[model samples]
Target: MELERAVGTYLRHVALERGLSEHTVAAYRRDLDVYVEWLRARGIVDAEAVTPELVADFGAERASAEPPPAASSLARMQSSVRGLHRFLVREGRAETDPSGRLRPPKTPRRLPKALTIAQVDDLLDAAGPAPGSEDASAAQPASVRDRALLELLYATGARVSEIVQLDVDDVAQGDLLRVRGKGDKERVVPVGSYARAALDAYLTRVRPALAAKGRATPRLFLGVRGAPLSRQSTWLIIQAAAEGAGLTAHVSPHTLRHSFATHLLQGGADVRVVQELLGHASVATTQIYTHVSVDALRDVYATSHPRAR
Candidate 1:
């Protein structure tokens, strides 16, 4: 089969049959586009014409490119190419997989950055007054919504993409929130009292007014113009609040997620339970937070102990 056609077929398979998310599929498309172009440049346009040496060469070239890509990026690109060839072989489009011997470079495991409890409080307060505060009733609609948005992000430790894609109906179950994560997988995460109260204020006091500004949307978070809040918008909201709080640390949507996981582990929540809340397919992914907790312990011990340094 032609390499381009095989890539198109594999992309469709992952998007439709395998139930991968649009974002993941788009990434695959991008990586494969580069791969196909590289092959075509070498007069190798057919799937069967690809060789393991050629695939290895491509990996080496990418690794040595000007301003070389990050290890995670190279690994993802390799996975994309590997998946394509494997799919082609399985479907009888090719006799052998060219990427069989192609191994992704190992990326360094960087511990996630999590804010302290006091810092989280400061960030949330910077978003707006809490739901029951004396000035809460007089806050702007956007401010009210920001408070709820940040609160939910920290409370649930959900990916910002998942949070932004949420619909009003997803939270209709009172204390339980039905979150649709990557691959359209659904998980029920409990909403804490603080987030619930913040949400209540947004839903009752702010959402209605915002919804009336534009066409009706079932989306839980809306922009000032009333469209569903986008991931970029959510990032901006987090940045604005971080700045208002006078925080010097870099903060993003994922920072709240990291903080949520770290705080839970520090408070003695089981790692397996945290794994479930995080919707990680494997507990290994969730265990990284344990390292973050251990680091915190080391820091405390270093400062508090009377032993020689």
Candidate 2:
């Protein structure tokens, strides 16, 4: 009862005082709950009685898990235990923090996957509006909307959420686009002539029809009924496009993002400039393209080298 009471207080402290997000607090609670249940299963009732052996066993069980838990997840679990024990010590409920000495297992990082330039082109071409032959009574307005979505994604490499939130006025110029990023920070990225032409087509022939209402709405992408385009709907558009293009890989709007950064990097764009275009908060985040480049080189080497197999 005492340990349970302490756990509740600790949880409140993490939630109210630490100001961690609800998702994070809920996650910590879940991990700690699992740990406590595992302890109870072993008939270890007292917090002080929880030994290094128990912790080690838990770590080993988690590490040796099949379809193994990721190292990042294991690290989070370890962090939860450390926090719980530290709370117990602080409240004078325990004499030692058993989890203090525990270490999480290290795991290898998976390299990022990138599509070829030709594959990217195929994907983009596939992303355009559905054919008139497919649906004889087809809506040309929606077709324009779909084409604009594809063009904007490839043009700015903006996140789907950002793209869907765009205003028709935002894409007026073919030369530049203002992008709102994380924390509502905004930046201007240049758009190519191809994207501009697509946007012009949509604006001229498509947008006004979808948006029959005279009210001035700021949203860029519009639904058939003229509301802002949703993230879920954007996902469906990308999937349909990939299928149309006969792409075997699972692709998303972000695949275009990866392709955008990759193609730019291959074309000798500076890492910092790519960082700005992607609106990555850190240059380190942009350096991921370098990894993509290395992976491309590896694929070439594997194909060309005599003993690469």
Task: Give per-model TM-scores.
Answer: 0.95, 0.65
**Model 1 CA lDDT for position 86:** 94
Candidate 1 C-alpha error for residue 263, in Å: 0.3
State the displacement of the C-alpha of residue 182, model 1, in Å, after optimal TM-score superposition: 1.9
Off by over 4 Å in 2: 1-107, 129-139, 213-216, 295-309
Candidate 2 lDDT score at position 251: 85
In Å, residue 218's CA in model 2 sits off its true spot by: 1.4
Residue-level lDDT tens digits of model 1 in 1-309 = 998888999999999898888889999999999999999999999989999999999999999999999999999999999999999889888888989899899999999999999999999999999988999989988899999999999999999989999999998999999998877789999999999999999999999999999898899999999899999999999999999999998999999999999999999899999999999999999999999988668878999999928
Model 2 lDDT tens row, 162-184: 78777766766659998876646
Candidate 2 lDDT score relative to the true structure: 0.78
Q: What would you estimate as the lDDT of candidate 1?
A: 0.94
- The lDDT leader among the candidates is 1
